[model samples]
Target: MATRYTADEIVERLRSEIKDRRPLFMPNCGMGLSGKLQEKGGSDLICVSPTSWWRLRGQGSLAAFLPFSDINELVFEMAREITATVDEVPLISLSGPHNPLLGHREHLKRLWEAGISGINPFISKIYDESFCEQISNIDMGWENEVEIVKVANEMNMFSFAYAFNPEEAEILTEAGADVIASHCGATRGGLKGAKTGLSLEEAAELSQEIFDAAKKVNEDVILFAHGGPIEGPKEVEYIFQHTNAHGFTGGSAAERIPIEESIYNVTKEYKNVPME
Candidate 1:
């Protein structure tokens, strides 16, 4: 099983990496093998979420945002499977706090008991302004995500909050999120990724804006970049070069694209062998 870490411990570990100028890498994993391999590859953190479950099953990452399965339950199931393979790396769950059937505190406690060390808000960052306003009207809004982060901190669990804009970044940082990741939209590149979104330069500028907003609330808050045009090593290097982002968070870029390419190539190579 993966080793569970306290919020402070996780922060200190990442801070040490930053002190040495090493970029942090947080990858989303749906399968045990993926998490195990990522741990070996020196992943700073592993995220188990409903979106990754959909991606591993050959569905688009957005499928998780639909009203299909219970999102939090799906994360727990994936976390259990992933923890069985990971050893020392910390596991963070991308979860929704608006489950009518489950309270957020209980959900967080269960995550901790299942060997997850952290939490990140999912589904909250994917909505449009209209939808966000509608959800906020019903009290099932971004405020719940902020409350989750606040509660996670009180419980000594790490919180990695995703913010789409500077305002959201400031709110999350004020809520005591240990890490604030500027989400640029759905990642682009894989078979199921977004084909069109912000350019790399635009994404970097947006990331810097979000980071600056977060730093205003807490200058020591760790900053990360995610999604949109930032796909692989080259694009992430561009983000690092252009912004003050401390690291990156990847979903499709980490698992789905690599799986698609590697499996397809290896299968093609085997099929190309001459027959008797």
Candidate 2:
């Protein structure tokens, strides 16, 4: 089982990494084996989410955004497998706060008890303006997501938030999020990844804008870049060069793409071997 970490401990660990001038690498994992391998590969942190579960099932991460299943419940189920395999690296679970059946506080407590050290809002900040407005009209909106971060902060649990623009970043920072990841959109490059979104330059500009907004609220809050054009080492390096982002958060770029390429290549290599 993984060693549970206090929120402060997790923050200190990340701060120490930043102090060393090392870029934090947080990868989202969907399975026990993937989490174990990521830990062994020196991941700064491992994140589990319903999107990750879908990705591992050969579906796009967006599948989690659909109403086919309860995302909060999926996080718990994935955490069970991940916590059982990841022994040291801290785990962050991405969850939706709009589950009417599960109270946010109760859900957070359940995550803490399951050995997760932190929480991030998933299926929250990724929608379009019209969809967001509609969700807000129904009382299931961005504020609900912010409330989850607020609750996590008050509980002394690490709170990481994803923001698409400056306004959202400011709100989450004010809610006491320990880390603000500037989301560009769905990641691009993998088989199931987004084919069109922000360019590298656009992503960097947006990241800087969001980071600035978050810093205005709490300068101490750590910052990261995620999704869209920020897919791999080269793009990450570009982000680091162009903006003040402290690290990166990878969903598809971390697990699905690598797994797809590795398995496909190896199978092809085997098939290419000369037969007797």
Candidate 3:
């Protein structure tokens, strides 16, 4: 892909999106959905992680299934793949607690030089419960995330901080995260009996708290909400009305859930066709 905008340019565009009050929907996608999302007028903010990227490329789950010992290698490979696939859209790399950036500054610089627009150091307890437990010996806390944001700021790169509540949002914003995302856990895709986080109303309320905390420090910081029950247009509209969030960072809500429902309905309808 041809290089278009610099990292600072991407950050400026994100700020512009907030100033305009137009909530940009950043759908986490790979080659399959990025083009379609662009055609439909989604935000230039595109997110991709090793787990999701591998799944998108038809490689199944991340390290759970694949034999990968080094996460840094995985991140580089994922960035390369996304770099080759995406054109103009700004790519955001979602790094977990295991990534080298948490410890090594040079690793963070490498991520920026690899054509990545931004970095989201996300360690979702609910989404990665098993992985977290597996790495219980290793310390992966909020301080590391703050350090990642600080490093990104030092490099003039955008940092999308994943925060579960208002307190986390405040700390991340104070740490110079360009975007403070209020996130719950990943929503269960097409599952009838599965656990989820707060309801949409609760998510909006939490977002308002996060907004207040973030505004206490930097009013220009881009705020967004994700996961939990905030999916679809009505939910998104509710969050914007109730909270100060400028948009949402959609993951499974943008990809798996819709595809599951659509494919099932389409296949069921075809299966029930009458024969002559």
Candidate 4:
């Protein structure tokens, strides 16, 4: 019922919110990254992943749903309760509605009004039986799947993804995908978004292709990569230095520890070994 808060404004105030940029710790539970952003020192912008968006939609739970189309008090509630306490920013990634046709505008609107950060809509597909790969399984090889792009452009939301094929890069750009995500590798980590396995070199090569393709179409778009077992220090370094991504995410890495300890483990030296 009230006006929404601005995501940009929140980003601007992030440093002040957390006092110091501590580890932007975002832990994912079954209920959509379960809003557990904590910090010891330094400021941080720990955000939540909208894994429940899909589940709620599938099960039809409005209460569990994020009012993404508009900003509601709940948005501020989440921001004030979580971010205010931890000194972090609340980013609601509307992941499942990656397909333009499936995106819930009303939900997105509410998020903005609540001062929740950007809407991260995406279109992801597994390498399936029809894997000849002439065109993408989802986009059908269109340069701008007019349907999805129109909504993102009209909303001015961030159109990010876990894995976007080179073929659909331009299509996504036109579709109003503000931030392109570099995610998903060969395996599924413990959770939904985490795609397991990819040596730093492999991740680097693939990420470069993504950046290069986007450049050919729209170089101005923000580049983001996420697929990783970001447990090792070298792995973190590799992700930051090699890929086009400005950030990296590791569900298993963060998921392995309890909250009380994870806050510290995030900075500690751990390794994610390949599955035997």
The estimated TM-scores of all candidates read 0.98, 0.97, 0.81, 0.57
Model 4 segments more than 4 A misplaced = 1-46, 50-90, 98-103, 113-115, 126-149, 186-197, 231-233, 255-276
Write one digit per residue (lDDT tens) for candidate 2, span 117-227.
889877555777799899888878888889999998888888889988899899999998999999888999878988656899999999999999999999889999999
Return the number of clashes found in candidate 3: 0
Full-model lDDT for every candidate: 0.91, 0.89, 0.68, 0.44
- Measure candidate 2: CA RMSD: 1.1
lDDT of 4 by residue, 200-226 (tens): 687677776776676677765655555
Ranking by lDDT: 1, 2, 3, 4
- Clashing residue pairs found in predicted model 3: none
In candidate 4, position 180 carries an lDDT of: 59
lDDT of 3 by residue, 83-175 (tens): 676677777777654444446367566776787767888564444557656555465544567887887788777788877777877888988
User: On residues 203-261, what C-alpha lDDT tens digit does candidate 1 reach at each position?
Assistant: 99999999999999998999999999999999999999999999999999999999999
* Model 4, residue 130: C-alpha shift (Å): 5.5
Judge candidate 1 at residue 179 and give its lDDT: 98
How does residue 230 of candidate 3 score in lDDT? 78
lDDT of 3: 0.68
Worst 10 residues of 4 by lDDT: 54-63
Clashes of each: 0, 0, 0, 28
**What does candidate 3 score in Cα RMSD to the true structure?**
3.8
